[model samples]
Target: MAVGATPKIRLSLSEWGQMFIAFGALAWPMIKALFGNAPWRMFGSVEARRDYWRNVALVMIRTGGHWFSIRHLQFMMPNDRSACRLWGWMNWTSVISEQVDMTHGAGEDSAAKTERNPSIHWVGQSPQPVSTTGNNSQRSNVKVVLYIHGGGFVLPLSNGCITMMRTLLRETNDPSYGSPVYLALAEYTIAPYAEYPTQIRQCISILHRLSSRYGVDPSNLVLVGDSCGGSLCLSLLSQLLHPSPKLPQLPYTKGSSEPFAGVLLMSPWTSLATSAPSYTSNAGSDTLPPNVIRRFRDTYLPKSPDLSPTSTSGAYKRVDPMQVASLSGRYYDAVPDPPIKGLTDGAGATRHMDSFDAGNNKNDEWWKEIGSVAKRIMITTGEYECFRDDIVTFSNDLKHANDTSHGKASEIELLRDESFHAVLVSDFAFGIPPCTLAAKLSGWFLSVLRNPVV
Candidate 1:
C-alpha cells in the first residue's frame, strides 16, 4: 500500500474491538447529556451546547482524538465517497479526484518517486478551457479556491470540511459576490507517511498544475486552509516569498511576482508550543486537547535519529531539510525549552519575532515581504480556542509586516469570533445550524473577489 494512501475499508478485529470500547466509554457522557447534566463549560459556545448531537460528537472527538491512534480513526471515518454519500448532496456537486504530478515541471528523473502522489478533489465546477485569444478573456472573472483541510496533519479529510467548502461555494457564487467561484480540495500526503517539505512540495505541484495545465491565473486563485492545514498554507506563502532550500521554486506562468489573489486562514495552528496562555486558559473551552497537539507535532516532525540519512528505515530514508532546519523555519516554530510565559500576550512581544516567537533569534525583516505573496489576507480564529493567543500574535506580526511592506494596514484583516477552534467547519461537519461565522467568512470572500488588488 502507498504511504498515506486511503486504506482498504475492511476493519480488523482489533479495530472493531476499539470501536466497541469507544462506544462503551462514550455511554456515560451520552447519558449525562441526555439528562441535561452535560458539561457546558467544556464546550466553546452556547451554540455548541444547543445541539445534542454536536455536544456528543465533540466529546467523542475530544476523547478519540487524544486516545485513539491515527490508524483506528482512519478506519472509523468514512472514505471520500462514503462521506459525500452521507451528505446526500453528492448529486448536486461534482467530486472528482485527479492524481497531480508533483514534479513541478522537472523531468521524471529529477523528481523523487513516492507512493504518495498528491491528488485534488474538484468539488463544484472543475476548470474550464482557457480562451486562445490574446487576452485570455474567458477566465478574467473566474476564481479558484484551493482548500487545504485541517486535521492536525495526520487525520484524513473530514466530512465537515467538505460541508464547509460546499457552503462557501454556494455563498461565494451568489449574486452578491458577482463572480464565478470554483473549489478544489487539496489531498496531500499526511504525516508519518510523509513529512515537512513533502506536503509543501505537493501543494506547490498542485499550484503549478492549476496554472500550467488548467490555465488558471495565479492572481485569481484564493488559498484557504484551517488548523494544521493553515500551517501548510503559511508554509506555502513562505516558500513563495522565500523559497525553501529543499523544495523547487514555483514557476509562475505570467512572470508576475504576485502569486495569489487572497488567503483565508481558519484557526491556523501557528505554533506547536502548548505553553501559550490560551493553551492553559482555553483548555476547557476548546475541543482540541494539548496531548493530541503534541502527538501530531511529534509525528509530523519526529526528532528520532532513525530518520537520519544513515538510518535504514525505508519509510523516511532520506534526511530532508526539515531534519536539518528543525521547527525554526519561516512558519513553524520550535517549542521553547523552559517555555515562555505569556509570549503571545502583547504585540510588542511578537512584533520582533520571525515566526511565532518561541525564543527564536531569526531576523524579523523577512516578514515584511509577506504582502508580496497575496493581495489581501484574512485570518480567522476562535476567541476561546487554544490557538487563540498564537494566532493573535501571528496576525499582529502579519499586519505589522504588511503595513511595513505596503504601508496599508487594511491589507491584513483579523476576525476573532466568540467560538472554539475551527467552530465554523466543525459545526458544518456535525450538521449544526449555520452561524454568523459562516456569513462573515462569506462576506470576506465576496469583498476580496469584488475588489481586485491591481
Candidate 2:
C-alpha cells in the first residue's frame, strides 16, 4: 500500500503468516524508537547487531512494499523537493558568489555557507598539493570518487552513506601524493517526485561536470555505489560504456571518450523485473524481505510484468526447463519461458537460466561495451542476499561479453561474504567499523592508480 499500488501477485497463506511474523518482529523496534534506545544503538557487538539486523530483515520481508512504497512516503515528498530545490539554488549561488567574492577576499561567506547549508553537502578533503619531488608525474593523475547514495530510490541519503564517504575520503587521502583523492557525494532526485531516468541523467551531468569543470581525468576516475545507488552506478556506467540515442546524453560528457579506471559495485540490485533464487532461498537470512525487493522494483521501474521467459505462462511451451537445468553449471544462452510458479510454491530450486530477458534487452549492448573496455570490475555480494543470483548472473554475463570482445580472458573479481544485503554500507549500524571495507576499496584504487589501465 505504501507503494501506491497493491502487490503484483496474491500471497499464499504461508506468505501471510510470514508477513504477520514480520509485523510482530518490527513492533519491538517501533517501541524502542518511541521509548528506549534504538536497536542498532543498543547492540554494541557485531553479533548483537547481526541478530538485530536479522530480525529487521524478517520485518522487511513481511512489510516489503507495504510501508515504504511511493504512496506511503508521499507525505514526505514536499520536504524532499524543497530540500532539493534549496540545494540547487545554494549550489548556483555559491558558484556565482565564489567568483564575486574573489576580489573582496570573502572566505567568511564561503565558510558560513558551508556550515549552514545541510540539505545535501559535499565533503571534500582537498587533495594535498603534490610536492616538487621528482615524482611530479603522479601529481597530475588524480582519482575522484563520486559516490551516489542508495535508499531504494525513495529515501534520501542515509547516515551510512555519509559515514562511508567520510571514511573513504580520509583513507583515500595519500599525503604522499600531492592532492589526495578528491571525493564528492552526489545527491540525486528520488521517485514520487522525479520519475525514472531523471536521477540517471542527474548523475551523468554531475560526472560530466566533475570530468570537465573539475579537470578529473576519466582514466583516473572510479565510480562506486551500493544498494540502489549501486543500481544507479551500473545504469550510469552502462550509459558511459555505450552512449546511444535511445539513452539520454549529458552535453558535457558527449564528446569525451575514455573509460573509467575501475568500478566497485556492493550489493547492487541488478534486476527489477523478477525474483531470483536468493529471493526465496535466502529470505530468512537476507536483511531485505523478498516482497520489499519486489516493492522497490515496482515503485521505481515501469509497471511491466517480468516477461523473463521464466516469469511468463509461455515458458513450458517455448523452452525446455529440463534442458535449461542441464546447462545450469555453466552459462547457457536460452532462458526457458515459464510462469516461474516454483518459487512461490516453496520450491526453492535455483533457476538454471541466466540470460532471460528481464527487460534489460536494450542495455545488452551496453553490457558488451563494458566487457570490451575491460575496466577493473569488482562485484561483492552477500552469500545469503536475495540479489545474489542475479548479481552472479550479471557478473558472469559481463565477463563473457568482455572475453568475447577482447579475444582474451576478462576476469571480473566476484567476492562473496557470509553477510547480508548492503553489509558494507550497513556495517556501522551493525557494530562493524567500515574501516576494513574502506581499506579494501582504497587498496583497489591504489592498485589501479599504480598500474594505470590502458
Stretches off by above 4 angstroms in model 1 are 1-16, 38-54, 79-91, 104-112, 130-141, 175-179, 253-255, 302-363, 406-410
For model 2, how does the per-residue alpha-carbon lDDT over 130-188 read when each residue is reduced to its tens digit? 43445222224667776776667755655455556555555446677566666566656
Tens-place lDDT digits, model 1, residues 226-256: 9987888877776566553456566552225
The best candidate by lDDT is 1
